[model samples]
Target chain A: MKRLDIIRRAGRNLKQAKVRTLLTALAISVGAFTLTLSLAIGAGTREYFAKFLETNVNPQSLFVVADKKLVGFEGGNTGPKEYDPGAANISGSSYKTLGQSDLDKIAANKNISSVQPNYNLEATYFTYQGNSKKFTGQVGMYDKTIRGEAAAGSLPKLGTMIGADDIVVPESYLKALGIKNAKDAIGKTITVHVVQQAQTKTTEELQALYAQGGLDALTAATQGKSQDVSFKISAVAAKPATALSDNVQLNISDTRAQELADFTTQGTSQHKRYIAAIAMVKDGVKPETVKAELEKTGLTVKTARDLQGILFTVVNVVQGIVAGFGILALLASIFGIINTQYISVLERTGQIGLMKALGMSNRAIGRLFRYEAAWIGFLGAILGALGGIGLGTLLNPWISRKMSLGAGSHLLIFQPLPICLLILALVLVAIVAGWFPSRKAARLDPIEALRTE
Target chain B: MIELKGVTKTYGKGGNTFTALDNINLTIPDAAVVAVVGKSGSGKSTLMHIMSGLDRPSEGSVTVSGRNLHDLKKKELDQFRAREISFIFQSFFVQGGDSCYDNVSLPLEIAGVPRSKRQQRVEKALESVELTDKTRQKAKNLSGGQKQRLAIARAIAGQPRILFADEPTGNLDSATGAVVEKLLFDYARANKATLVVVTHDQDLAAKCDIQIHVKDGRITEVKQ
Candidate 1:
């Protein structure tokens, strides 16, 4: 018989035994449901993380830092290692110190376009206009690599850095500054105060300065006092929706931030120390290549892809566990198909005899039963996948609300290719599950089968 | 023409061997109505099985037309059966769940007839068996006589050159049995096809153009 005829006959036979066929398919559907849902959730989370990176991170940038082990820290390793005299991060080196030497090594790489050491801006108070009251909150740098959305005014455009004398403040700072709104605060001045460190002086030098200028000069030479810098309010940003970094009260231009950092550490032992630096890759260079080279020199380099991996690893494990359960259900359902098909074969012995006597080949007989199983699989997979998608669509809003992922974010997303491949794979599994029973049906003797009546 | 030469069929092994057909030689002419009559287990059914290529003989050969049945490959034998051989069983053997049209369409489908042309063939076969009105009804819903007619419709639907009727009227009343007998004979005469009837009813066997009587795994008499 032609394959199309066999397939049609198979479908008809399954239709004849409707209840049994559906029950078997239902068993398979349980697994398919779990697997498809897990796949959707997996794809959703991965895609969401990628979108998060796209908005906030530069793909062509690498974050480089001195490895704790390279900087003479014990790190996560258990065993002791031999010490070297040139080890950094020692006492007086300050926190997360990647000094001038580390910066120099990174700058020497051929693929690197520029290196900007992440500077720490220290401030004791922020006061804008007539609001002289000191409000202590963290200050951060607005650099070219940092992408932000403004609430009222516009942020720096692509390839452009924040102006040296401008600051971006949040809504809370606007309210603290007694400004009516973000729009009103634009072009207004905000002052940040820091205590400048006094330089050390010998008594001889202090006496010479006092002899030239009297008591006022002596007090000025020995005393340390607060200093304030002013910047125009250039824009306003909302509270960050991402979990990437701490929330800052206001942001200053990168150049001014560096100057503040330099002013704070002048004539100090930790003057050139840095916590992290963004190594911008050349236009056509792959970030991974430069990352590898930076790592070879004992620096820890992380590309955007690595960050995405870090985030998705957790998602993979969770989704894998769910899909694993689905596989277990599928394995259990295979036995269901075996049992059902075997019973079908037994029930249709006479019919099989009739077909065989009518000249249906043993191969066709086998294909008949196998295609019936394929039908069952196709039905179950379609039902289960559609069920997952339906429930996913309905539950997305609830999940987003509960997880506080802001608006327009979904926790369940279905992609076509994986779902189609998944259904095809399930159908193949069902065919294999039907194999032994189909063989039993095929090998049945027409004479014995006819005589069975 | 169907020819059997020194055909022998035995069952089991060593000590328990039972011969079902012993040294049977026969020649059946084309377009003839032949009856094989015997008591139960008298090897008449076994004879029919071998002659129809449903079973292989332990020794010798059976040929239909020009092809040696035993020498044919498995696929070739199947194709031969699909195209040239048809059967009507004692129990009516019609698929109960399928519609009358579908039941009759089975043979044509197995013969690799395309769907577009099978409908006319099926309708014609059903019309011949006088089940044309019951074409859409499930075979199980038909009475014994109608089911038997439907089985006959299925048998002739493939337009086979040879038809086997194994007690085709065994399950029907005398009245219905007479009707089935007429249908089988009419189909044979109209198509100019060879008809072989295996039966226990002596009266039914007596109506054939030729009769082969069997006893104890051997043919005892041939009547014309």
Candidate 2:
């Protein structure tokens, strides 16, 4: 018999037994649905992580910090360290901050184009109109490379001078100031009062005092002597300005930042030292190579790509496990296919005998049964894929909203290649499942089959 | 011509062994209507099965149109049966789920007749059996004689060289049986195909041009 004829006969047979065919197809559909959904979730999560990394990290820049082990005895120390009055006490250990000489040494590398030092600003109160709010501030040289997205306005342009009159606030700062929109706070001038004390104190000592008596006692201890400086709000970012809790950041020109450091510690022997620096690698230079060069100077370097890789690995593992379960479901469905075909063969014994006596080849008879299985697989896969995509699309908007992942984001994403492969795989599995039953039908003795009631 | 020489068929093995056909020898000329009359268990049906290549003989060779049935491979034997022979059973063996047209079209399809020609041939075959008006009706809904007529249409639709009917009118009333018997004889004469009928009815057996009688799994007599 021709292949088309066999297929037609198989389809007719399946139609004759509609309920059995439908139930068997449903079993296969369960597996296909789960597998497709898992793949979609994996793709969506990885895409989201990639976007986060792109928006928050600069590919060409490396974060350079003092050796973490040598920075603090809390990390574990081999011996007692010499005491330096100018050293910043961080986490119960006094560590030398990055000085001019250290910056010069890092800047001498051939691949390093520029280095911007981060400044530690003292606690101060900012008054806008009649409302005064105390906030801890950190001063940094304004550069276009700093990683943060603006809710309104834009970051300070590269090579543009940011003097004492310029500052960048956080989203929380705007909320605290009763501003409903980020764009409304742009170009507003606020007065920042820097409290200058008569005596210089270690960072740890200052923190202890602030914890004990709040900012009011520290203000009184400074004899109320403070200098007021005015700065214009340049931009508002979504993330907080500094790692410090509740603290906002002020961006100023390097010259102005140096001037503030000198004025804040002028009464004592302490001098200006930077907490950390960001090294900008030139175009076409590998950041890893530059990181290796920087590590030789006793500095720790990290790149955004490394962090993104770790996140992607985690997503892949999760996807693998979910897909594994889907495969198990498909495996179970394979047995269902086998059982259905066997029953069909038994029910059609007399019909099969008639066909054989009509001179249909055993091979043709086998192919007819296999074609029936293929049809079941095809229907199941289509139903499963459509159901998975439908559910994903239905849940995407609510999930995005709940997770605060901006509009147009989907938590479940379907990629075409893998889904097509999944359908093909199901068909192949169905064919395999039909093999034994088809063989049994083919080898049946026509005389005996006809003799069966 | 079709010939069966020393053909014997056995079932099972060891103590369960049973011989269904014992050294059967027979010959029927082309275009002749022949009947093999026997009681149940007399192996007349087994003789038809072996002649049609539906069953293999344990001993001897059967040949049709000068081709040895035993020498052909499984696929070739099937092809030979499809192209040169057709069958109608006592039970009709119509696919009840299908339309009368589909029931008649099965043999042609199995013979690999191109789709373009199958409809015309199937229509002509059904018309010869006077079932064209009921072509669209499911086989299960047809009367006993109509079902047998549909089976006859299916067997002759492929225009094979040989036709085998095992008690073709056994389930029908006399009036309906007469109509089916006349249709079968007329179709065989028009196609010049050898017709072999197996039956216990003396009236139907006497109508054929030749008759063979069987008893105890062996042919007892032949009359021409």
Give one digit per residue, the lDDT tens place, for model 1 in A105-188. 998999898888877667988777777587888887776775766877778875467789988887666666677877988888
CAPRI band for model 1: medium
DockQ of 2: 0.60
State the displacement of the C-alpha of residue B17, model 2, in Å, after optimal TM-score superposition. 2.2
Full-model lDDT for every candidate: 0.86, 0.82
**Model 2 regions more than 4 Å off:** A62-109, A114-146, A150-279, A286-309, A415-417
Q: List-wise, what DockQ does each model earn?
A: 0.56, 0.60
lDDT of 1: 0.86
Model 1 residue A182 distance off true place after TM-score fit, in angstroms: 14
| B-chain TM-scores per prediction | 0.99, 0.96
**Root-mean-square deviation of every model:** 7.2, 8.2
Candidate 2 at A290: error in angstroms?
Answer: 5.1
